[model samples]
Target chain A: MENDGMQNGNENGRESAQSLAASPLEVHDLTVSYNRRPVLWDIDFTVPEGKLIAVVGPNGAGKSTLIKAAMGLIPSASGYVRFFGRDLSESRQRVAYVPQRTTVDWDFPTDALDVVLMGRYGRLRLFQRPRRADVEAAHQALQKVGMEQFANRQISQLSGGQQQRVFLARALAQDAELYLMDEPFAGVDAATEAAIVELLRQMRASGKTVIVVHHDLQTVQDYFDWVLLLNMRLIAFGPMETTFTNELLQKTYGGRLSLLTEVADLMRHEQRKERDPL
Target chain B: MSESQLLDFFLLRQYNIRVVVLGTVLLGIGSAAIGCFAFLRKRSLVGDAVAHAALPGVAVAFMLTGTKNPAVFLVGAAIAGWLSMVAMDAIVRRSKIREDAAIGIVLSVFFGLGILLLTRIQKSGAADQAGLDKFLFGQAASLVTADVMVFGAVSLGLVVGLALLHKEFKTISFNSDFAHSIGLPVRGLELAMTTMLVLAVVVGIQAVGVVLMAAMLITPAAAARYWTDRLTVMILLASIFGAIAGYSGALVSYLAPRMPTGPWIVTAGTLIFLISLLAAPRRGMVARGLRNRRNSRKTLEENILKTLYQLGEEQGGMFNLRTASDVARRRRIPESQALRGLGLLRRSGFVEQANNGWKLTQEGETQGRRVTRLHRLWEVYLTEQVSIAPDHVHDDAESIEHVLTPELELQLEALLNRPTSDPHQRAIPYH
Candidate 1:
């Protein structure tokens, strides 16, 4: 705690550090820019432990950038991220990330079991290979996601849902205290979505924090206990019942977003008619 | 050449030939091994640019050292090759120009400069520079023991580095974002991959030259991809392919007098690729064509069977004989197509010719019933579960019925509650 306070440098930041030390993740004055344009502006929040949280926003709203910037995968224009009030580098082992499914080439020459084996690589020393114990642990992780039978199956041959499950299995093998998943539910089948939700619940029961970049607005209340409404800025952040109100949702997705959706839909309709000559 | 000459060439009996062959073989093994990483990284053309860039360095190194030393060539080539890689990446990152254009620009500019320097050096009449042009197409026959040692050590170092860092390499190549999040030095690992690629190209440009060095990097790796789906196995197979091409090319040059070994090496690699493209199992063009033919044949035969079964049902009998034209009319296909299908079924003992017409055997009746049953099940599922219009279900179910497996059939049955009739009021047979 003393080290965390000193790193914060100012009395105000030190006060917040001491208060946020009990939380799993805290972001203070976070702003992320891409190509000299700020994608996320002045984001600030501290998340509690053992809660399933969702970050929801419209297209081009910097949802993924927040997660990447917080994990130090992308440089932030301003502000910093802390896990348990410590720098990300100091507590990286306690945090895990599942990137969007499209970020990787699924057609890579590897199998499900081998992809899962990557989860254990962080614990291995430099130039060391995965051992028998690591292999056994990887198997257990796959079994937890109901993918033990497809362990030897090549990744490209797996269906969309199965590929998502393999990704989840890889994250499960990390065995971390806090998980950051980017759109894990996108393009997955009903069964895979259900399995992921069940796994998230189990993780919550064990006092592990899970933050998801959720896309489906219809199931936000049903899937997560906490909601962080964002659209290039923090609109609201609190318990799902209190913060997930229509006013905040409207504030996040108001005006330009709805008009944009309408124009896109109109263009799609016109294109379909043009294709069929109707 | 006679058989003994061939044997003598392969057995390494000739000292000069042995040195050249060892150098080329090691060149192949090293380039192809590291080439797998480059292939997966989609940086195959970077090798070409690097190799082309090395020529200028070789000409400069000779001018500075005033020697034809192989060690100096390697140092010069490696530096220039590494520089080309840096330049290509910097242009791609800092400008609007695409990677392909950057590679093209770097490759041609560097190669053009090398040729300019080479002409200038030749005009000066440096007697030791007589064979400097061999670096363009390579002089495999002129490899001395020192040259062989230099090439062999560098090539082997590339292979050893690949083996030692395979894990980190795989993680970074497959998913660098995830690797970065997990605390792996992704930027450093990328530099390592790039360095190995440059080293492989620079070491190989001596034997394969700048023009054909990319083949050593791309051909064996492409052929290996069709043979396996595992990275380690692909690397192993690619190295073996490269080694075969290496020695075979050297042997061809030895026997054919005046033929260049580098081109022959690439030719041997292309031959292997052609064989893999046509003959490898599962992914090969020939195998896919064969499977497609078998599938269409099965589909035609089953459709004919179903036609016969339906005609029998109209007549209230299972084994009534029907003419080929009658079968064709019922199925709305040509008579010849129906006859061919019946002929194929007769060969398989599913049908018999008797009384100037064809009749199904007992086994054929059971098979026909199953196809009909699958069609009806799919129709029912489409209409009852999917809520599609009843009339639209037949065309959709027709194609799907042929490919549905027994497990899917059982699931469809369970999902649809084992209905006795489809949406069109056709009975779904159960066995």
Candidate 2:
């Protein structure tokens, strides 16, 4: 059954490639709602392969929500997201997600190496333990992030930079073609920042796609080749040189879209009414 | 009971004793295994609510079936427990009430309803309903061989189920979104985990009772967390702790005629938790207190060394008889503290007491200069790299000087490019 699904996906991928070379990620008219109120609205974009993309916006702009919705971590209200011309379920092995560092409890009873080993779980059969090769791959991932010495250390004992590196190492162990990271440099030290940059450069050199939810505007031009300017809606998205203009950034961050916000507020008010039905 | 009687009870020679102990031990292991996930998920109190909700089911099953068959009570309890969880989730999602409030509502309402039904059943004057009240406070003494066999089998099944899905549980418990993004069927796995948790509660309810059963579920896992940071090891330790609690509880109740088994078991679990909280190596309160004391002592010693080094510089780098009172007044420290600091330095060969006061030996001078250098180097690094104001750097440098290792000192030195002095314009001391 799984083979049939994979073959169908491959055929579909080939057909899409014939028309317009299939980008690494494609989302069309995607709208996501939480608690009956929309968080991301009518998002549409296509991401080029083998480029470092930064999704930049202000707080509550649904930057993490976009990545999560595209990966099917949360259900979309309307529209669809396709990866390599296929649904997420069909292409999960080719994609990896690095959630925010604060999303997990570091006090969970696990060491750095064990966390990295989780990256290989998607490839294993049900009820199967990680084999020796998986452990070796996890170790290699740890080494790549310069965290091998601390691999045996409890996760809670790690400093902020070290914890970020461990998270990055987990993503690297996945060996996915596309990596979506949320605020990887949020609290990391300079060394970890450099290590992450080097890792991203290597990934791009090897023809893999990376999309990061970036908060620092200064490094946007220097680090990313492509930019997706978002504020509850896609303001602009393209190569950084052409798309990351002063006007677009001003639009994304300037809070000039008050009409949109007002409409969203009205919709939320109605949603509450519908839920309560009194 | 005498010591020999205690020995015989512990040896499992008595059939009834063996049955009760085995039942409670299996109950402990099962609750703890599933409880680890619940505890990690921050749903520790949910077990308490679920166990409490099962009480009404017990009364309802007894009223309807008019028999004490354990299977009927199990099914009834499972359904009620599941319903309470569902209600709690629905209330949280559909209303402005938060999860804790929703849980509070469901736990109390169901528990209250159970009490009402239990009182009604008592008023009904039915035969074989005499011991149904024991479910409120468990009567492990009433547990027969057949009851032990059934409870043990179910508990074993729950534990084995957890083992089979250990990786899935770990992933979801750690990061649910990552698990979902990886196509791990996170919701279905959560449902499976919840089902096992319900089964665990159901199996243990007869031995620990609904009132105290939550302690069995959570205490062992919380205690085990202090011992290790590996999920598998934590689960293993939790199981062992749970078993020990069960064994001791059973033994105590067996030996004492009037003692209730449920309270004894809960007390044992609490005792284990207290021991782990106070004595476990890395996470324990005692170990942390000791570590804090050592750090503070090192800081104090370094401060005294720096004081001595400055005093020597003022005296043209010659040994002088500096009384403890003089040093204490200069450093603004208590005289007793100065004496203690000097005593420690003396033992370490950093200072020697003469007739008038304490003096720094040649080795003491070198050691004192190293601490001073470290203090100055950190101040420079903070001002230069961390961008702290020159005036704001001294206090931080004071505490950090004692903790900075040799490698960090080298890095700070290189980073500062061998600055001759700190931002304070004081000449950087060197050994």
Candidate 3:
């Protein structure tokens, strides 16, 4: 059954490749809502393979929601995500995901090596345990990220950069064709950021795809090959040289600045009214 | 000591011992297994609430049925215990009350209601009324072989359930978000965990007594954490500790007739906890303190080496005690400790006294330069990567210098673009 799933997934992937040669990931007319209100609307874009792509937007610009929707992590109101011409689940084993570091508990008792081994779980049968081969793979991944020495160290004892590298190693251990990283650079030291960028470059050189949700605009040009500028909809999606312009930045972040400030003021007004009644 | 008397004791009194020992062991195993997960989940206090909540259920069962059958009362106790858990969760979910506060509120209120019901039951005058009173503080001497068998079966069931779902439980506890993302049915797994917790609590109430059952659930797990970080090891250690406590408690209660089984078990659990608290290798307080002291001594030695390196760079070779003391003062070391640190450094052959002054040996010079190199590299990193101001980097880098590994120093050098100078434009010698 597992082999059949892989075979079917590969066929679907081939078909998708033929349809969109320029874009390995294609999202069409995507919308996402939360609690009856739309957070992302009318999104459409495509990312080509083997490029270091950045999903850039302001704080409330649905950047995370867009990635979540694409990964089938959140319930989308409408739209379809095609990965190499296949549905998300069909190509599950081929895609790797790294969530925000804050989303996990660092105090969890597992050591650095244990977490990296989890990347192999997707390929393993439900009841099967991780084997010696998996452990060796994990060690190799850790070495690539320069965390080999700390493999036996408890995760809680690591510094921020080391912790982030551990997560990267786990993702590398997955050996997936496409990588989806959520704010891999956030809260990390510069050395960690450099290491991750180098790793991503290596992944690109190996013909694997890498997409990251990046926060710092200054490093965007240096880090990513392609940029997906977003604000509720696709502002622009193309090579960074062609799409990253001041005008596109203004359009994504312009109107919301004053509007968000006004909402904050109104909230403060309502809170005051509740407290003072006058 | 008579033969018949001994026979009577063995035959008649032996049943009590069997019941108490078996019940305590089963309860210990069940509660410890669930407790391992609860301890990891940071919901250790919830076990306390469930144990306390069972009181009202037992009381209500006796009130309604006018019978103190262990089966009937335990059913009611389990329902009430589970309901109290639900209520505690609801209060936290719906209200602004924190989880601990909710637990405290539900625990005291349910227990208070149980006491009220117990008083009412006493007023009603029933033949089986005496049996209900034993639930307050467990009367292990009154336990029969049937009760032991029931407890054993329930505990075995919990153990099997936990064994089957160990990986899923671990995934959920460590990273619930990832578990959810991977389509692991996190909610169902959580419910399974909670159900096991309820089962552990209900099965334990008759043996350990409601008042002390929470300790049995939490203490063993807490102690086990000091011994191992792996979940399986932690659970196994906890179960073994619990079983020992159970057996010892029952044995003591049987031999001395005056002591209650519940208190004896609690005492045994506490003893294990105290032993773990003082002795466990990694997380134990004493071990951590000893490690800290060793690290501090290493730091002090490193500081002396760094001081000698600075003197060598300045005078082109070595420095005296006065200059060393002055440098140590600038580094915030007291005069007495600084002198002691210098003595240790001299004794260690990293430094030597010549012409009433201290000078770094050839080996000392090499170590000193490495320390200085690490310090400057860190300063450069702090300024270039972390965006710290050049002037502000030295103080922080001073402390970080002692801890930076050789590999990290190399990474820093690469990251800083192999700068030959510190942020302050001082020449950083790299060998």
Candidate 4:
């Protein structure tokens, strides 16, 4: 029995190694537009498995749009996201996404445990409620985030950090191999930031890939192992130590300031013309 | 009246009572079920629009068919109501007009057209059209067995559909983006919810007129919110309230010969709303006021204890009650409460009577200095990091000090760079 267990472990390790060699998340020549105006130019990148990656860019640099496009939440002009060597639709069960904290209504009449149980809805039948096993998994997820005491509390009563922890708990209950979180650290307290970083580290340690859209350049080194620098186009994609530098940051954020400013001005001008009809 | 006389009056001549009871029950259940989702989505007025929009359809149906068949008129009304809702949505989406404005526009235009049609039909020499006009205000006492069956079937269908699609409806209402991301058909779910709303309104029009339907949709849900923070409980409570109002309205209209059922139903709904508003446990207005008053009294008592402790800390482990009173004056606490508060402090061992004056006990001094430290720390944090004006910082700090947990105080300390003095350069007392 011991030998068989060892063999099983060995096979799992080899399978993971082969999967990592062929990137788990691959975006190929992706281009997106809003109303026929380019937002993201042709972009291509691949995120290897079991790594904590950060996608960092300036505001309006398509940081959020990139994640939304990849998740198939929004229509893309031309591109596709492959998950585990398949399209996103085919392998959606193996993926989990945590949207921005502000996107959900806090005043909704649900407790912390109820929201976490939503993660199991994809696995359960449409008309069914969460089973005992699903409930246990939700409880375990809450415990992992140190929010077990708040499971029965109304979501409206939670502080900002507690709310973010609940979102994380929901994602944890999904038990997916790949996680995509959009700005988990934004507006959170320092303790929550540390806790979330630690959670992501644990996910990476468990041989699961986690991609986070992050702000705050100073904490990038402390949080993420891999980095994808974007400025509406693929600026660079590699290990943080190799690709994250002043030159790349300048190219991604600094040099395009005037061009972005011009585009925004033109958009405003077009909007005014449409409104006035003169 | 004699027993036999009363029996005859109730048993045989009390057909109106039966109609009222049955009609109210169905109307209440149906409206409350649909109202729960409408309230949740913050589209409480959509029911109002659809109800009013049905009026013209009812009149038009009568004018075309030349009959008072409730089913035919109701079907016509439902089609009209649904079309108006669709038009309103399209206008809001295509144009820059806000949803509220679009609802107002659609409601008034469609309803005005309905009134015009009713007036024209009445003038066209059809005596049966007189009864059709009663639908505008509702005549619940006139409901027959057929009407009850229609309402019961429709209400049952809505409730069952809601039960089957409960999870999907909740997901879509609470978080549309998340629903879409998870491959839930968001548009289909929304359309299903809207269809249920239209059906509820169509069933309710015979009992409550279009003008009063909004009250039925909004009141029960608003009342239910005061009782529980769970969706299932809220929906159940709302349905019960709705049913009570519906039944009462029907009963009143039956007992009184000429009274309209819609207004009576609305009156019952309003009464339930008033009870929930004042009597609910957590979110009720009266409960919140009581909690606020209790918290204020506690804050005052904590302040008095801290002031006495501060006096003891300054005067080397002992101070007279006069000195504590003077410190309270500096903190702007009223002298009368301060005295009464000092007496309570003495009972609690925070202070003791000695030589015709009060002095802090060991425990009292520890707590006083801690409050003082919290106040000074908050003052420093506000003026240094938050960049509040020095004068503005003191008032905020004074209020915040009482609520600051040790964990939060530490975060404030780190955020303010661990300053030893306030912006005024006064030394901050520390434990």
Global CA lDDT of candidate 3, please?
0.79
Every candidate's DockQ is: 0.67, 0.75, 0.30, 0.49
Cα lDDT of model 3 by residue, B318-421, tens digit: 54443556656656778777677777878888878766656677777777788888888888888887899988988887789889988878878887888988
What TM-score would candidate 4 get against the native?
Answer: 0.87
Better of 2 and 4 by TM-score: 2
Native-referenced Cα lDDT, model 1: 0.86
* lDDT of the candidates, in the order given: 0.86, 0.86, 0.79, 0.81
- Judged by DockQ cut-offs, the docking class of candidate 4 is acceptable
Per-residue CA lDDT of candidate 4, range B1-431, in tens? 36764454346456646665777787798789779989999999899999999999898888888988889888988999899989999988777799999999999999999989988988888877667766777778778888888888888988888888888888888877777666677888898899989988877887788779888888999899889999999989999999999877876665664677788899999999999999899788999999998778767767876776555556654555544467557668677777777777778787787766677777877777778778888888777667788888878877888899999878877787777877777666666
Residue pairs of candidate 4 with colliding backbone atoms: B24-B246
Q: Among all windows of ten consecutive residues in candidate 1 chain B, which has the lowest summed lDDT?
A: B252-261
Q: What's the distance in Å from true for residue B376, model 2? A: 1.4
Clashing pairs in 1: none
User: DockQ for the candidate 2 complex?
Assistant: 0.75
Query: What interface Cα RMSD is found for model 2?
Result: 0.7
Residue A73 error, candidate 2, Å:
1.6
Better of 2 and 3 by DockQ: 2
Q: Is candidate 1 or candidate 3 better by DockQ?
A: 1
Model 1, span B1-431: residue lDDT tens: 79999888878998878987898888889989999988898888988899899999999999899898888988998898988888898999877699999999999999999999999999988878987777787657777888778778878898889888998999998998889878898888888888888888877877777888899999999999988999999999999999988888778767764566678889999999999999988889999999999999999999988888888777877898889999999989999999999999999988899969999999899888999999999999988888999989889888998999999999999988899998888788899
Give lDDT tens digits, candidate 2, residues A152-201: 99899999989998988989999999999999999888988988999899
Off by over 4 Å in 1: A1-16, A256-278, B256-258
Docking model 2 quality class: medium
